[model samples]
Target chain A: MTLPIETPAVLVDLDIARRNVLAFQAYADRHGIRVRPHIKTHKLPQMAELQLDAGAIGITCQKVTEAEAMVDGGARIKDVLITYNLLGEQKLARLARLNERVTVSVVADNATVVDGLAAFFADAGKPLTVLVECNTGADRCGVGIPSEAARLARRIAEAPGLRFGGLMTYPPADGAARVQAFMSDAKRLIEAEGLEVPCITSGGTPGMMQAAEAPIASEHRPGTYIYNDRSLVARGVASWEDCALTVLATVVSVPSENRAIIDAGSKVLTSDLLGLTGYGHVLGRDDIRIDQLSEEHGRLVSDGQIGLQVGELVRIVPNHACVVTNMVDAVHVIEGGAPKGTWPVVARGRVL
Target chain B: MTLPIETPAVLVDLDIARRNVLAFQAYADRHGIRVRPHIKTHKLPQMAELQLDAGAIGITCQKVTEAEAMVDGGARIKDVLITYNLLGEQKLARLARLNERVTVSVVADNATVVDGLAAFFADAGKPLTVLVECNTGADRCGVGIPSEAARLARRIAEAPGLRFGGLMTYPPADGAARVQAFMSDAKRLIEAEGLEVPCITSGGTPGMMQAAEAPIASEHRPGTYIYNDRSLVARGVASWEDCALTVLATVVSVPSENRAIIDAGSKVLTSDLLGLTGYGHVLGRDDIRIDQLSEEHGRLVSDGQIGLQVGELVRIVPNHACVVTNMVDAVHVIEGGAPKGTWPVVARGRVL
Candidate 1:
């Protein structure tokens, strides 16, 4: 099926996306660390398969709905780990159901959450894995100290139908050393009590670049490597050519000589500014800035040097690719400027 | 279905939502104006039905997929108007098909777009209503002056299988008076040439509060009023109580005495910012500031007076309601602190 070169459509360069997957897997291989790419970035089973085929140990997801979507879309059992605190009856029920299908492990900082997971799994007659998430530095979700991490892990092991799955942490951006130290200390404290340490998962895209140097972590979970974006480019992790996703938009209205409006806007590109001024980077013109984006139009402010006419087509690399993927119904796959096919963002709004 | 008091789930106060619909419809009724509530706000057929039942002339959508979703979900025929420029073969084919089910009209600012629609309808053996969109000052999509507007309208009228509907303009935030003048001039110019003007549509929630005073427009398309947001409140168009939608989030991490983190971050709340200093307004706590938002965590800086512990629930009024609605899978209908039901944001990611 041929797609119109319209604004706001997520365009995936399959070649670049595959290369991104391979690069990360190779990095993990070189360091003897297991790779667990987070599926939250693409939210597609095919991408997950690519990672798994490239030697990923498993995948991590932020929401149960995302995990469910992935498993239902053909992800293997005993490979998906959810990195969110499980709360409430509805989510716990879903979590219990998910445990029946896979080796589902969840993170928790407080004993209350561990008890809740224990009650859920015990009632469901299933054994659930619990990871004591330590706040190495991010301070988002995790226990503060090694003693607290040990206490949470001990509570999980003591709770019925729960098994201690070792330590997990989403460290700060510059936290490779911190994660290494915390993991080493927490493991020693837990092992000193003669308990088993089955896993040590610590990863995020920003921290993953330095994670290979951290000897304590057995596995890494990097989500954004599958589709590098402008944020990654800014951080020197990836380049423009490495960005696998771009929004295909049409120049709808050229109101003035300097300003032209594209059909793609905040709804498709997303307002995930990611600290970058302007919405996204124009594909070919470094001089042109997507100055503003309304609901359905992206205003492009161009330097006078590059002359752009009305009704012309332009590709924009969004600041954040994962959020952009969530904002669209379907993404068009293209190879060398020719449309290949369109894939529906099946789990586009699975925000439970 | 019992839902936990999470901090970041989109909450639609059914009473206030219905009231906003009724109030907007009442204003249209008193002025002898047609009110077409934009479905891009809530993206639910049920909400659109409530507006129609309360005397809405029709509904306005931003994309072909949105219109398709609404019509498939039981929106009335001969009433839905798509206020976007239709381009490309795939979208034009959908537009031609949509004309069979509804009174579908599109706005175009350029002759190329007008010609594209005309060719598609001509090939389909149908006549489509085309509105010449005038850029009264939004600088988004539309012709700049009345002469360009008349030129586009004349081209549409002269083209085969296309009928010139009327003039449409999405005015700037403070350009209600400018829209009145521009539309009046365009209408007079077209009438002087013995042309028929069927409709004059002016839109924008900020300008819609004063739309009745603008005599040139026969209809108004205000999107955000169905769920007033912090931007509307900041603009003095609506009050805090008048806001029908909010994000119910959970305080998952109280890292420090002055810092708290919630589960709803940029991914759920969106990063529209819209020139606001913070992400959203924490209801009943003007002292707390949403300092930053990562993809899945909202960091709140408290002013020490308000003591908030972990696992506490809070309601956040989003900076922009429409963008936030597009981020979620479903919205909870809350009445007096209890969830009446959950409505799937069926058209949440319909950005074709």
Candidate 2:
């Protein structure tokens, strides 16, 4: 049952992954809401299909390329929501092509994105759906206030070949209250303008379970919940066992009594510590600290109490599973501790 | 003519890159020593060939796949030294195949690696050359002391189908004194054992100029010298103008008066800070601080003086050029500020 794969390879416990898919669907089903798992987590069409089988509304992507990957990679999902500001001639054309494929919608915080998108889709037969991105608390992309969202929504509704698809917000972790307050005001303003607010999508894995706390949102988008990471575990949103993705690395070099090097470095495990102290958590070894990572080598400093032999396989729980997933070209999927097959990370490096 | 490459793409200044290669080669030639540029920095066959054109003796790779990449990707290198301890039957067979393609040598610090390699190459007609790696000051890999290296060298010499190829050490930056002392002792021990000591390779870009001061070394391997980064700039090993690699990202969202979001996030620019405070240095915008990064978003908080607008292209000098090169599949090569062609990062993600 041992995986006959190379070192520094990613392994996904598919049973656990399926369980994660079902568990999130159960959570959403309990709250009488729809679950739309973000495809950015695994970036594989297979995972997206599994989420769809578990009753997800659609797949969520952060960029046009990501959405294109899900559709073309054989996810077979009919609905897609791109949760980023799409701009430029190149991306807008890609967005139009994507919208032609499925019921596609995108979020925009500024008028520039809206104008660019409108210019391309203005001649389309079916109107494009555009969501007004509201800044609940992430402070990255989105409108600052409810009025801004209302104004953007009106602009989308008035633009040719575009429809107002309601509001969307990517709030910070533990900011469900702020989302509730902001989304409620934006929704009220949009409804007062005699426009139908079809969907309000709010997202964040840390605040996933409490997404229903913002009762105004119709659907939720949580990317990392399908894989879960050190950040999610630290926030008590998920336990270590709930994590389906793990990097199976080998002890390549033991430099000293206190230091050992693994084949998984920044290229594999990644430097996204997610505000955690160490690079990753080594399963079954609490004393080993993954203190540093070079491009192709991860240096682990041990407590010197337990000796690790060279060539021993160690499973590592990375700080952020989403970023780790993007680092690799494929993952070796397993079921019941037996190697099943390799799953292509089909959408990896599709940052365009 | 400007490059038609999309935003958030990697750009390589070929003129500066060629200058870096020639300058390092000239230094090695002046010292009457051989220069082997580590392909781990650029990872492209074109780049490796460029180094060869600049008068490098050979190439250095951290993994067998990289060697395979250089040889198969048309670098046409005759000699390659893999500075990693090759393990497992799969990698060994691959290494043998690589050796059949070109002259291949590897490094080993412990008897386990030596024994494993010996077992794999025991029946081969041509003996595989292996170097005893010594840890002078950098506590990452290699044997601890001169005796350990000497013992390993003796083991390599006695093993069937293997040759003791002197010593190699990836010393700490500015540790010429330590490398000299340890290599001197190791060389004396190996020579006393009646084995021909062929090479003594020391490596580190930060200590490139001072490596010649360690008279015990025969050759030097410095990868980052070709594409210097913010780390080399901070350490005074390279100037700002010497940096040849940059990530061209567009300001996607200006969240506030002092905040901007760029398309180059951890996925493109990476999260390898290398002890630097910020992620990267934006060219001509010291007022902008690339304070944080998400998967597809780089959050920049400014001093509110120089305003950054959406769609404006900003070139960023990353913290570590080596890791940045690994993140992209291809880089846009430029000459004299005009668009050249794109160079495929052929060896990228070859962590195995």
Best-fitting candidate, measured by TM-score? 2
The runs of at least 3 residues in candidate 2 whose Cα sits more than 4 Å from the true structure, single-residue gaps closed, are: none
Q: Summarize candidate 1's per-residue lDDT along A301-345 as a digit string, tens digits.
A: 877743665557788889999888888777888776677788777
DockQ of each: 0.51, 0.77
Which tens-of-lDDT digit does each residue in B200-310 have in candidate 2?
999989999887899889999999999999999999989889999999988888878898888889998889888899999888887878999988999988777438887
Candidate 1 lDDT over residue span B225-284, tens digit each: 989999999999999999999888877666567787788888788888878889999999
Runs with alpha carbons beyond 4 Å of true place in candidate 1: A1-7, A75-77, A309-311, A334-340, B1-8, B75-77, B123-125, B335-339
* TM-score of candidate 2 on Cα atoms, chains taken together: 0.98
Query: What tier of docking accuracy does candidate 2 attain?
Result: medium
Q: What C-alpha lDDT values do all the predictions have? A: 0.83, 0.87
The backbone clash count of each candidate, in order, is 11, 0
Per-residue CA lDDT of model 2 for A171-279, tens digit only, reads: 8878889989998888888889988899989887888888888888889998888888777888788889998889988887786778888888888888987788989
RMSD of each: 2.6, 1.3
